[model samples]
Target: MMITKEQRSLYRSEGYMILPGVIPPAMLAMLREECSYYLGYYDCIMDSRGVQTENISHRGKRYFINNRYRLSSRLWQFIFSDLMAEVARATVGDEAWLMHEQWVVKGAEQGMKFAWHQDSGYVKWYNPTTQHKPYVTCWCTLDEVSEENGTVYLLPHSRGGTKSEIITHIKEDGTNDLIGYTGSDPGDPVVVPAGSIVAFDSFVFHRSGPNLTGNMRRIYLPQYSEKPLTRPDGKPWAMATPFLKDGKNIYNHAEDSAENWGPFPEDKNVVV
Candidate 1:
């Protein structure tokens, strides 16, 4: 199995696990290439709009490019691969859906720090009444990450509180980041190789430091849910593309439809 018993135990209790350098070298290369392409695409879009900042993104500093997997010729290979299936089965369940995907990047010395908040905090902010099981975030690293390069810090359930529920987050004024944890405990820093995947529960509290090094820190984050997550109105909050059913991959490239993926929730406070 991809995840060991000890690793699974840690995840069950702490809500996060680091699978060190698990991605194949060739697959990692492909993900990095796709990330570069998408980063350029985001810049081009920003240039066309004649704006330095879009939503939470600040030009040349930080970026959150989301849900553009259809544009990449090879991204589906990783998204629907055996590696991801194993991860989904481990963290989510036998049935899984692609809830969201994004390239979260921090550029060189200007990369800003991300605030501490659960992944579910964003969902709760958008749809307060909606309830769903905790999903899994496969934080696939495209570069070796450390505290110096904006690596994520995770707060375990024991320290951060219960993992079964979402905490209401307060929006920070300037950056539009949502804050959930304000206590003194410094979360556990993740320092791992380029191809590692840090899988965490959606309810886990996490944050990152600013990039202090002279190189960009890149991470391709793909989230999966036990089932399609919906708003109180019953509309999908994000992409709910089917990946696995009954412990088997049911994704069909030919049948994929961006139209059916549903509209990404409109968050005026944050950019897509």
Candidate 2:
């Protein structure tokens, strides 16, 4: 989990870095299988075919709360395992806290497009200021991603830049909302074989395209933040859904500090 100096630069300038083969293949396979199982559960519970049918959006499909204990117990350790956390700490510095987990699955025929927007936009529903420190999103690829399979596309440094200032908000229609950015170029779509990990700034503008590959494209995105960087309104970090409480220790060590986490200037040389 040692990060190269180049990673630091890319994270600082582009707001993202792709670390391939960071997670083992076995764990990744299990994650995919378990996710599929959960999707079935979610579809069963939230299926919109009834009188008050649920209109689950492709982008909102991550809301399905599959069994947390089964999933978190194992994946949580894999995430905070010394190696993984070290990389996270280096880029984000100390005060990082486990934020939340999102399972993004797009079925071939039902796959949908996510409009380009900053992660912070959705985050603003609770936090509104730009003064807080940046948060990190560790997106783990469960299936091979490609142009046909709807790989994620990043807009370089879109977080701090004024170009393409699209924000995520709720429209009057009561649906997920999106704004457009006119001044930015689309960063290349990152295609990774299963087991690769991509870390990016929570503020970076990113979105996924349609899946024409005739298969499901699945990804596990877990967000984390350094301590003291509260939401804009000054709420605690635990307000985000799926957050664990202090000392609960439901999974992993469940506690971290600046000593165990901080920026590493040495490993930045390795190119992702």
Candidate 3:
């Protein structure tokens, strides 16, 4: 669906917008089922959904699988869909490339939040070719979510005007990664139904709480942007992969640009 004027305004002003039910049930179902491989393959315990526990394997999170869209066909279907391209067009204005993706499952536990931070700080290595600045992220809920279920809290229009600096290593920094920026506003917890989308500007400050509810909170994140002028020193997405380039699904057509680079090593659980 095309973006409305209100949606654009909200994104520009609030640094985020929740688009309800933008993903159809069929697509959501497929994406959810694909998660089983993660739950089953990892040393996960059995639950109502057939997967129970998970220890932090990668991505600096206690429970998350990173970059599945780089290889998974099913995941790619959701990312490269016409619907995704449409959203990218509206969000980034015509020439957007989906440079990254990840699946996060916040289990019921203490201090399980994704933490509050800006994506632009993480992309400080990226040299943007456009004037739009930092990239954008589309977070799709795979399960019914609530503040009690660890949904992210977003500070409205929080791109700039803050006293914060990017921390280099989140894991090594102890709880410093969770520290708030000077003059930063406390965020509102975002509650969206399953299959809903929460898209945010790159510089928006957002974080979630620990899961108090006895359920797994699942979210699939897709990051959209133009090709990076330069890749991060060691992080991936330093170059363009073009999941959606120029508001089109380039993944389904000819070879996508990778700037002759291959998959980099997994990022140590140093989250943004």
Candidate 4:
């Protein structure tokens, strides 16, 4: 769990950072009590009542995956939970891999918002300085995040800036509407507390809103790469399609489970 050299120069000149408690309160109390027992019996983590099923979660939030190599494997111990692949092998170096996993639920009141964009425009298909220029993601939180409860509003470095730049749009009675973007603004309600951990740059530029504090923020997203990278249209960025495997259909991150097993430890006794 050591990624320091000024946090790898703030993850290569400010794309993201917030490490905080690199996760250990008994593995965050067993993944926050298995995410409150699956957000109370299959609300599928967070569907509050917007009912939509095939579960990959964006609005209904429920995307855990860990196919085989099991053991209460909720997305395989939180995407191979070894202190987030030891900070993704020190900011994406030692052949980092994982590939995908996301949980983001927001309940307290739940209004569902997210729309700013840039998770490599939905998991970049390829090309950005020769094959997805160093992917990296980690959100963590799992509760205690805030902006009155709908935290995470980022923009950090906006990965090489300018996909046209300028974006704000919050409407639906939350009004913000600015629209446009390429980079700049990676901040706002970056609260992050309950076991913090942010680490971004999948082309940054985030978004999120609507919770109005009652309790319930949950976060867990994960995505790491370097495993023989290739994209920029060369293919093999790892989603060869099977509708993108893992807990079957919906929100592909190579279907979670630390992208098919490779990062768990905080539980079977601390030994690295």
RMSD per candidate (Å) reads 2.1, 8.6, 5.7, 17.9
- Candidate 2 lDDT by residue in tens digits, 1-272: 67898988888887888888777777787777777776776666555553222332433322324114233446555655565566566556643566555566777755665656566655554444545456777778888888788788887774447233425444323324343343456657998888888898766777677777667788876666665345455655432222223322223344432244343211100001
| Comparison by lDDT, 2 against 4, better one | 2
Candidates in order have lDDT scores of 0.87, 0.58, 0.63, 0.54
Residue 67 of model 4 has an lDDT of 20
Give me the displacement of residue 215 in model 2, in angstroms.
0.8
Query: Could you tell me the lDDT of residue 148 within candidate 1?
Result: 94
Worst-scoring 10-residue span by lDDT in model 4:
263-272
Give the local distance difference test score of model 4: 0.54
| lDDT measured at residue 213 in model 1 versus the true structure, 0 to 100 | 96
TM-score of 4: 0.29
Model 2 has a clash total of 17
**Candidate number of the best TM-score:** 1
Candidate 1: regions farther than 4 A off: 257-272
Candidate that beats the other on lDDT, 1 or 3, i.e. the better one:
1
Report the number of the highest-lDDT candidate. 1
TM-scores for the candidates: 0.95, 0.74, 0.77, 0.29
Q: Which candidate would rank higher by TM-score, 1 or 3?
A: 1
